[model samples]
Target: MSDFVARRPIWSLVILVAVALLLWLVFSVWTPGMEAAFGRKRVFLSALFNGITLGALYFLVASGFTLIFGLMRNVNLAHGSLYLFGGYLGYSIGELTGSWLVALLVAFVVVGLVGVLMQVFLFRWMEGQDLRQTLVTIGLSIIFADLLLWSYGGDTFQVTTPDWLSGPVTLPLAVALRSNGEAVLMTYPLVRIAILVGAIVLGVLMWLALNRTRVGMLVRAGVDDRDMLSATGVRVQLVFVMVFAFGAGLAGLAGVVGGTFQSLQPGEDTRILLSSLVVVIVGGMGSIPGAAVGALIVGLAEQFGSVYMPTYAVMLTFVIMVVVLAIRPQGLAARR
Candidate 1:
């Protein structure tokens, strides 16, 4: 970042100015004129928070995608199906057991095991065959989608939010001033905040595990040259299988999160799969940090566009993707 700022000082300055303006808009008390021009402060604030939380959700889904497609070079296009399956499975588990946390674990484990089967029986045989992987996974995704539709029907389902995280939590940020001269603080759902926090923590842990551990070294080596790693008496295939499982498990976990905050029905798999692909492309393929940056940018664009320019809202996400592709086809944070 420092090097880029030095090389592109003008662009850096523009970014700083934009951030400052955004901060002022968020923190300052809007006068009547400002409110008239920009709508209510509460609306803006809500959009901003919603964007951030949504980005967090995207990160959960895309991180897994980057791991499988980017790192492992396994084109699991059936990923969205995995996410939808996980959500449905989690919902069923949650219903039967009445435990949200347990549902989370079960989804992760079950979906991860499914990933294991894919890696062992399918992807492993077609190693380095991108076109084949793509076709096979597409077929699998269709089959999975049809199966899920058959079981769940066309009805939408939302996972029950746990009791502790169900209510709205008051934030210190003031959205408006009350008539009595008191500030009207912002209030947001606790679950969203928790999801954001969890994403950040998981991201950090993943970075550490991938960069700081011996297993990480093996994984990186395997990605770079599995033949060499295997020749070194390492179980490179096993490592890859684990990575695939973990990545797929993350999709399952994200499914539960999505089901909790949003409704699950047919076609959501496509939406989320596209979102993950866009995020990975924008953030940089095979880059964890890139996924984070892309997710945030996409999330903010979606929410703010919807709130401010409803007609062009859906187009805004694609516009951002196009701009990113034009400026940095490799992505914002390409893997080193």
Candidate 2:
């Protein structure tokens, strides 16, 4: 942190100011004049929390993408299809069993198994062949999308938010001051907050698994020099398969998360795939911290842009991408 401040004091100062401003905006009670100028605090706070939780959702999907496409450097274009498939399957399972947790577990296992199959049959021999992997996955994505459309149709579906997490909870932050000198606290969907907490915990666990464990060491070593690691008698193929399964499982888990809060539809796969791609590219491929930062930025940009500049909201993401590419193409948290 000190190194960063020393190297780029101006940027550090700018960031500090921005954070301070955001904190003030979040905590301060808005007067009529302030509300008239910048809109209501409730709307702003809602957008802020929405952005945060949405970012958490994006991180879940992109973390898996980071593992496969980012860390392993295998382009799995069918990833989004995996997500949509998981959601549909989870929803079906939830309907049949009336157990959301069971549906989540089943989705993870089933989708992880699918990933293992893809690894064994499709990707095993094509290790260094990016073009082949890309083409095959693209074809697979199309096939998966068609299959899902046939099975589920184009109707929108949302997983039943479990009874435990169904309602809105009031936050401590004041949205406005009542005439009685009381603060009006903001109320948000409890499920979103729960998901955000889950995402954070999951992210920390994943980071620890990848960075602090022996298996993680092997995974990293294999990525850096597969031949050398294989020469070390590390059962590289098995590790690869396990990695694929885990990555795909994470995508499946994220599907359940999305289905809980957001509706699932036909073109949802494409949108999610694009979002994951943007997050990965923006955060720097293969870095978990990068994924988090990238997800947060993209989420906030989308939410705040829609709130403040609806007409250009879609363009804002691409613009951020362009600016990042021009300034720091490696991404904010990616290693130099």
Candidate 3:
């Protein structure tokens, strides 16, 4: 059985695909019932869109966590704090300059710098010390959270989008609906579309960098075996620093993008941090593709669960994590 499972995971893949198809079939057939229950067909579409958007944001944040943990083996618990800091800083800058672009750039650079500083002053010394790294980062997160609350207050704040992305885009639904006997159109926020596009682009770029570039080669080698990578006359520390900074920059960028749609609150740091952890765990620690897939699953699960099972919505992510762990304790794509 073990040999067969190892030789042909094809059955597992097939089962997954079949399950997805079954779900789709069931949902299609049950659309009318859902509309009857929810009083609208648009609810599903709205939830789906929200899921995609939230998933993109989760991917951005988790990608950074994946890189830092996957390669450096550093458990930076304060990652979400950096995300919140970026959002608040971006919001303040945007308000002052009245330019979202500027805020985005500043937030990315500043938060990235902060990440680099944290690594140099705090994490660099604690290399290979997981316990120390975790505790220190948690401490930093707490300090940052308090500082932010004192400065920004407990009031929730949201970033303003550019004029072009301020409205909704209408999507034509070609399929005839049972109720209308005609095609229905759907409208979704333009920003959501932009977020999805941005995530795809970022994922592609990261893939290329890891697979096609020299630096990416080094990072991959490091992930596989750090001591060997260092012995090969390569500056592994420098690579680690650069990767950490880049990951921090990605987190900051996500903050600005997410803040535009979702309000930034005092506890958002912890919330996003928890979400990123789930993404990493479900996707596999340190796997970029895994993070993307995990983020999408989480996003969809959260949104759809909220609509269909409001009472159980919060437990959906935990359920997914538990299921994934039970089936593959190492995650969907654990490092071999």
Candidate 4:
């Protein structure tokens, strides 16, 4: 018998599918009303939509985090502050201009600039000093949280979804039925679909830019070896700043969408930051697909867990992370 054989990507995908089917089967038995509830088709579709939208938001936030960690090798504890700040900025801008497009653009630019400034002023000095940088970012996160609390109060604020997206719109997947002898229907939010589509397009574009573009080539080279890239005449410092700014910009975009999709509040900074950190760890530092996959699992797990076991919802994330780490200390998709 051959000791080694070439394995195709399809094999991995098949395994994944098999595992998913098995999980569904197990849940069907262990959790009553699950499969039946989902069998309604509308509820299942709704959950699928929710998962996709949530996953997109996670990817937007985690991509930049993965990027920065890949390039600068920093944990960026303050990324959540950037997210909160971006949400606040977007809200303010939208209120002033009454245009979601303008608000989104302004938010991205403003947050990206902040990222650039941080790189120039604080991170530049702290390069190669991971501990000091980590502490500084932690302090910054605390300051930002406190400032937001003082300025915005602890109340959660919902962003204004554009008029077109404000109300529940009829969707193809929506199903109508009778509830307790009364007519009822399941509806899908148009905005959620938009978020899912936007996230997918952005993810694809990002993948292309990172893998195909000249700047992306430099970035990849830098990731493999900053020293060698620098020695070979690439301006590694400049790349670092650009990558940092890009990552921060993505986080800002996530914040804006998150604000509208859910709500923004003072303490959300920590929550999102922690979630992003967990995502990075489970996905493996610096892995894009890993981040996406990990984020989907974390997001869906939390969402579903909240419905099933509210008390365990919070711990479920950390628990999963711990188990994944225990099994593959480097993470699920860790390349190294």
Candidates' C-alpha lDDT: 0.92, 0.90, 0.88, 0.81
Model 3 scores worst on lDDT over the 10 consecutive residues at 22-31
Number of backbone collisions per candidate: 0, 0, 0, 0
Full candidate order by TM-score, most accurate first: 2, 1, 3, 4
Steric clash pairs (candidate 1): none
Model 3 agreement with the true structure over 204-269: per-residue lDDT tens digits: 999999999999999999999999999999988899889999999888988898899998999999
Which tens-of-lDDT digit does each residue in 139-207 have in candidate 4? 888888888778878778766889887778665332433445443445677888788888889889888
| 1-336: candidate 1 lDDT, tens digit per residue | 899899889999999999999999988999999999989999999899999999999999999999787656776789999999999999999999999999999999999999999999998898878899889999999999999999999999999999988999999888889899999899999999999999999999999998999998887787677788889999878998999999999999999999999989989999899999889988988788989999999899899999999999879989989998998899988845
Q: Lowest summed lDDT over 10 consecutive residues: which window, candidate 1?
A: 67-76
Clashing pairs in 4: none
User: In model 2, where do residues sit more than 4 Å from their true spots?
Assistant: none
TM-score of 2: 0.97
Per-residue lDDT over 1-336 for candidate 2, one digit per residue giving the tens place of the 0 to 100 score: 899899999999999999999999888777788899878888889889999999999999998888787545798999999999899989999999998899899999999999999999989988878888999999999999999999999899999888988999998999877789988889999999999999999999988998899999998888677789999999988998998999898889889889999989999999999988888888988888889999999899899999999999878988998888889999877876
Best by lDDT: 1
Q: Count clashing residue pairs in model 1.
A: 0
Can you rank all candidates by lDDT, best first? 1, 2, 3, 4
Error of 4 at 116 (Å): 0.4
Candidate 3 Cα misplacement greater than 4 A, ranges: 1-39, 174-182
